[model samples]
Target: MDVDPAASAKVVGNMPPNISVCILSHNYAHFLRQAVESCLAQEPGDYRLEEIVVLDDGSTDRTLEVCAEFGSRIRVIPLPHRGFAATLTESVRHCRGDWVAFLDADDWFAPAKLRTASGYLRTGAMLVQHWEHVVDGDGSPLLPDPHPGGNTSTIIVDRAAALKLLPVTNEKFFHVLDDLGLGARMTHPLTFYRVHGDNMTDRATPGAHQEYMADVCGEIAVRLADLRITPPPWASRSALRRLTWHYRAEARAHEVEAALQRGRRRSAWGPLLRELASTVLAGRNYRDRGPSIHSVLTGRPCVRLAPSPQEEP
Candidate 1:
């Protein structure tokens, strides 16, 4: 969480901007405390930790007890498990902060997370996502390498800008929002992402998660076409089925590549060669503003900025 000393010059007043740490949880009571502690430990120094709210959606466990343990340090909103995107929307409405930092209950943040993110948000990037430390269920680092991509816990956005993409961003496209015609940017790693067995994306079943990701991208590509952009060629008639074919083919290649990452497979050349062919053969500029065909096919990073909930998912 090292802030470039030059970033300090942009600090307007002694008070920090209103930044809320929104913890989205279900039955992850065991890890919830660590997530809460991570936020409580932060000293915004400039505006305030305006609201640290937990959108607990239909947990049949001791999740309520954990919130009570905080003793008013944070607010707990009991929701009836509408889904991930819906709870996130509730977070936007319930929070009073000008900037919202989302934290998944299974993960936590570094001590300087808020302090560092606040500085970068001033750079006028409406949506900012930092890196994540991929960890095991027990809060231990799972890999030597870090995930320099996006995660729910890393999205810190300007409230007003997020409200614009409300209706367009539904359950199918909530977390997949990378380039939704918004000014999105990336920063350093500060959040921890836990790959527990019960995660939303299945990791153990090989191609399971990759297939899900492919579908997510296909749906996004269709929606991206509906936006005020030049729209890609794949957005023509029967786009979902057609685009999904490309997405699934690329996803299969990525699944093999990922297997190689864990040292479970040795046949990396096939997938790598196909990836090369796809990149070289496919025309660039899948609508120019980028969420590029290459980017999606290669598992590249993207942004997720939802303007509102009652609007999108």
Candidate 2:
């Protein structure tokens, strides 16, 4: 929760923030309080918190009651269940701030998260994200997030830029890895990303997740080609190659899981061996750090290498 005073001062300057925070929730009433309180706790000095909006996507739980608990302090938008991208686009449309920061109902921000991010955004950066601390359901620290950018909770984006990139429909392109196309990454750990059994990403069958992710990568490539923009360091060929390895690893892992479920323990070895060979050929993207091939194959949380530091603008 401690922010470097020098770094804070450098971004904040004398300008007040014109920011809106949007929280997306669906059947997350259990964790909604903590997420809302975290936003309410932001101390941005002259920077205005402006509005905190919670878009409840047709929760059949106590989520609405939770929003009502805050009363007039925040804006609550109750809508029928629309999937992630549509809900996000709808929430963005409701925001009136110059900057928008998204927090998933299951995730919470660190103290001074908004203060620091707003300062950086004021410097004209199109997007800014901080490091994420991945944790378990009980809030125990699991590991430092290796892939920090593009997560909805970790990023703050310019309103104009977001509107252009995030679409209400045909949104798969902007769903999970959208941040790669946005802007810069900050090295500070400013958000807590909770990994639990109920998470949508975690709930997806491994094979389905892998296929969806591969499609996402292809879309990104197409978008980059169309725009004639160079891929950022994190999304370059090496990064995509690393992602490809993980996809293949996850697919093989799923095969092993199926074998074990069928009580064919010996059958798992063939896929496991193929996975090992792929890992050996992946080459290292980080010194002694690479994709968590074992974790993918075992249905455990996959650890990734942290992004390399980039020169600040």
State, as a TM-score between 0 and 1, how close model 1 is to the true structure.
0.67
Residue-level lDDT tens digits of model 2 in 156-187: 76676556544533233333233334345577
Misplaced by over 4 Å in model 1 are: 1-15, 167-187, 225-313
Best model per TM-score: 1
Q: For candidate 1, lDDT tens digit of each residue in 1-313?
A: 3334345344344446688889999998998999999989995554468889999989989899999999889999999977776787778777888888888898898998877766656654556677777777776776676677466787787776555334322233433233332334445668888876677655444445554555554455455435425433312334333333344345445544454434444444455455444434333323432332343455542322221212211
* Alpha carbon deviation, residue 303, candidate 1 (Å): 20
TM-score of each: 0.67, 0.64
RMSD of each predicted structure = 9.8, 8.9
**Candidate 2 clashing pairs?**
17-47
